[model samples]
Target: MNDQRLRLDLAALADEVTAVDLRDRTLRTSRRLGIQRAVATSAAALVLIAAATGTAFAIRPDQTAPPLPADTPSVTATPTPNQSPTPTPSTSADDPSGAPPSGGSGTNTPSVQFGKLFYGPADVTRVKTAILRSWRPGGSTVQLLALPDIAFKGNMSVSSDGHRVAWVDSNNNLVVADADGSGKQQIRSNVDPYCVGAAWSPDRRQLLFRELAEPGGPGRFGMLDLRSAEMTVRWWASEPAACNAVWSADGRTIALTTDYGVTLYGADGTKKRVVPGFSRDGWSTDDVVSLAPNGSRVALLRRNMGGGDAGDVARDLRVNVVLDTRTGKQVTLPLGGRTLRQVYFQTDGSMVVRVQAGSGYAVLLVDEDGKKISETAEPASLKDMQILAVVD
Candidate 1:
């Protein structure tokens, strides 16, 4: 299980691995500029950090991440509903109770498309906006402001000096609530309905999550430790299953990409480095590793085919790999979009993902060898009043 190749220097083996290599050295290859592109994968040549000290995305081949010919947010426009999570600083909600966690306390909610706080990537000089939902237990700031239906799905994490913010609530629990939701608490709960978030710590305090239990089940998946207030698990199964998570940016190492591959968990939890094949349903470890505000490297969207010949999955998509979460090594982006439920990872590796198209998806922001930088169309009015709880 060894890809053999080695040079080892990922910032001295993941400490924020940096040697730098992204100053634009010339590119252009949607197939020799003939442009029939889409259906790609296969890459190498890593290390790049100097846009002062953080950045991603810059693929070329006449550059084409296409497919925004514009169908537009499906055109009905309706985010202005029952809104009021407190801070319209900007950002997400989805489930309004369909019956699930009966043990009760499920209060830290936010889903229904989800949003409670956002505004990430802060360090090149410190630019922030990180608030994101929290605060329920004693009532004075962990801010969960509304909590009724629960929202703020994924990506908006911060740590390398952006102040704080590490998401995931609704019923999946595992919160840190501050940087906006102010003082709210919990530190842990049932977790993983597909759980894919809660990463912050390289000094932001402590957080990282993942779980999948069954193989011999008794509970134990991968990295889990919030440090103070209470919660502490970090049990990377030698058995059971379900484990995919990431957290680096000084939170002290916690990378776990599994279905069975890719791992790194120190900060005192142990199990460092199992990563050889890495796959958590192909690519996407919850909130997708994408770190780098000084925590040093980890930007993965990954899933490529782009050498084409598989035809028709909606006109055949070809390439979209972007790994290097500390030397798994990869880089290629020229997509056509197919399944992608959500991606979001910016600071250069580039991405805003969620493409289903035609009848639904339209959130494009792809780049970093994948192209198509911004296509947002609509979904911003916030007027009604029932959005209930997204307070950052």
Candidate 2:
């Protein structure tokens, strides 16, 4: 009976040990599963946070995240409604007029057409050799001629059609040449060496110039027919300083500025009218005078001689006085307070003016009513240069 009891107890002990070992194994497996679930939950939470903040967390095929470019920022996949894409260049045809398209650079836009402007040295007295050049608006200057021993102390006159130019030479001879300095001709010799101005007729067939009876004597007006090569004395003036002949566009009237005032004469040398406010003694060396195409108005520089000695007087050189020959009253010009340097009347009764512009000069085209039409800045190389003629 004792032996049976022992065997039964041994069997019970073995069952108990087996049960404890199974429980221990179950606890270990539960703890291991709990740790895996916690790790997976944390990883999912991180991915969710990155998506909500618009930060991309890229995963590689190897289940690892690589570093992003330092310079690049995390961007959202969707764009706003107002966002515009970068524009690509177009290959369409350009404008037919060679003008830039709208919203293009204005620096490449075409400038206003001011025609060819003939100019020379500002101070000819200092240079023995000088060049005549032509400047077009928005174009480079081209040398037209090289003058040797230039005797004329004034501006040259270009024909209305821009075909010819006329000036006096060092030999006291009237020289006429093509606009390009070709086909030169000495039409008249032994003429007044100091005849500072000349004018071309409306037909471009006659030239009006000054003639002196003798050197250092009083001068008169002369007209030369280019076709016939005939010369005629048109008018006789009593003053020695009477010169600067300007013609009306119709070629019916002529105007001369004298020491006393401006004298208007018919084409037949008859006295038409005398507009008397100008004094040649007070005028500057480069003083320009122009007559209206209809012979109704005259423009000149007005000098204000202040109180002082003749040599020390302060002369104002800024005022431009345009007088109506019929009423002898000043016509107001819209100059915008810019100082006038020179003025020339166009064939259409408009005026081209050179005004002082901050150490350089600017050209302005104004209508008959003194309204600004267009303006262009002169090249810096033409500072203090003279506008001899405007070829339009």
Candidate 3:
């Protein structure tokens, strides 16, 4: 946990941060009003405030390349939906090969090789290794822990309970270490675990892993039951839809999406309802946004039926939508991205959201109707860091 100073500015569009409709994923603001003061997106049914800064955006491969090289991304983007139309929350955002976007003039920095970063306790940089002599930082007084062999490279994922952490080491081993960096046990796998990503059950007892037991064998799907220490492979490819397996917090039905749309399945693989029109149809698109404690109201990233943000990329697109999961009838809100990620709802139906904005993340406790009450950050040590979780 290097005490490196991370300074970010968000003084562009200074306005009172407030409520956003949870129906669409668009904003109701503009980028020309200088730097944004702060965004107010919440964890549950949050909205966005897209303000395109003059700063270079990571140009898509399909988009016309910017003359200047790209810089280290301050953001992560999901790969574009495959042309084949598969359903899954866990698909690589790029193409079928799971590649990152291609565009470079030596300045293309995707922040891939700096090392898997995380909020290490508070902010302390000290380590005592038994492997080698005293490891030190670049002759500077600042403390550093450089365990080259114990590499935690690639994508790092923290469990929902925030206790265990799983990441791929340089050797492609799926390693689960204690949040306090104590017990480090490596799970066996040949392919990089981070490549396909790993999903821990709500109880963290089982892992729904995507792998092949043998090189020439078929891709394996299903549970690595910790309780029994057994591997129960399912007869499903798991992809072309997205999620490998998403267990309910209590560990019951696993809801997933396929090439067509979202579906819920029993623990024994009994197919439930195939959520309709999650993909684009008649100008409507929906994605499972949340699973409340009661499992009654499932939040969705719902796009409008007849709306376009062609001219206003910042403020004229889709909004968040909340659905009564039991019945298909839904209630749409005009939420935007800047504030969508700010909203957070508990299993008890209570929610909190950030009221102010900065490049650095800080959560604000809000009232029921999306009103801000306080601010808190998502425990991190980097600058402008927003944590995105991937469940395979």
Candidate 4:
């Protein structure tokens, strides 16, 4: 196939890939500062739309892409129960089931812990409560804590070491606690009218959170020092605006996304440099970007924009590209037919991806060269199964 034809094919396939998660869409539109919410990676529903006079098509960052299909049904499944040999959170029979794929090992000691958070039935009786759980990847799970029914628009974050979890509590306090819900403590009260995003420092001793100045309005970023129990604004910008921040594994540099591009910041909140060849355009409004374990690179998903009827636009496409933080060089892996849902970089530079599977999704580890390392069996329930941190 010609290069042009191949581009068209990839774009079409990308459009067809769908995973419905309302929280992701809300963040893209709202960009509240809090925890990383799960993005949708549902089913394949590709359609080809021919380009029109006003439509521009390009595979570069900062360009508009196709929007996700409208009204994609939300995923609803009863979390199946599983047996675990390790300690796990308290779970009811109807709780979401989580365990390593079969043949992985029933007694495998987990090097990493995964966080699973679920909100209630959005169908008839609105159960506004939220539940958070922690589990060793491919192992057993332990219930962390549960929040009484509240507005479902905020965020929850877990530390890279997987030993700590944080979120905004009912009293609008920034709460940090042990992964298993022990030693719970409030870090800051009324940190923001809405605490929407939170990220831990590499050492897990500090955290940066985004809080809306007002409901659904642009907000500033703040940092919390756990030892001192002090919280202060991080000076993310001279003015309040939406930006996404992630810390390097060493905690020396922070990658912050702006309307222009990605910026690096010193731990003391000093500006480093604007990353070349990295544009904030074409990304889902929420900043779907991840820092490499070494902090020298980043991976960001394209914000797909669709136009024209399925017949006129002729295409729908999306991609995840890795950018070199130092040189701003980018690498796009040829995933073939895989629909990306969640992505994280390992300490050795390999990438672990969660992609769409039959009615659900599965986890796979791939090398930098786009080669598959290993993949776990498809879990029976993906509703609340979220991979929070990876330990190799």
What overall lDDT, based on C-alpha atoms, would model 1 receive against the true structure?
Answer: 0.33
Model 4 earns a TM-score of 0.59
Ranking of all candidate structures by their lDDT, best first: 2, 4, 3, 1
Q: For every model shown, what is its TM-score relative to the native structure?
A: 0.28, 0.62, 0.45, 0.59
lDDT tens digits by residue: candidate 1, 75-109: 12112212333332322322222112121211321
lDDT of each: 0.33, 0.52, 0.34, 0.46
Flag the better candidate by lDDT, 1 or 2. 2
Comparing 2 and 3 on TM-score, the stronger one = 2
Best by lDDT: 2
Lowest summed lDDT window (length 10), candidate 1 = 44-53
lDDT of 3 at 131: 14
* Model 3: worst 10 consecutive residues (lDDT sum): 54-63
Each candidate structure's count of clashing pairs: 73, 0, 60, 35
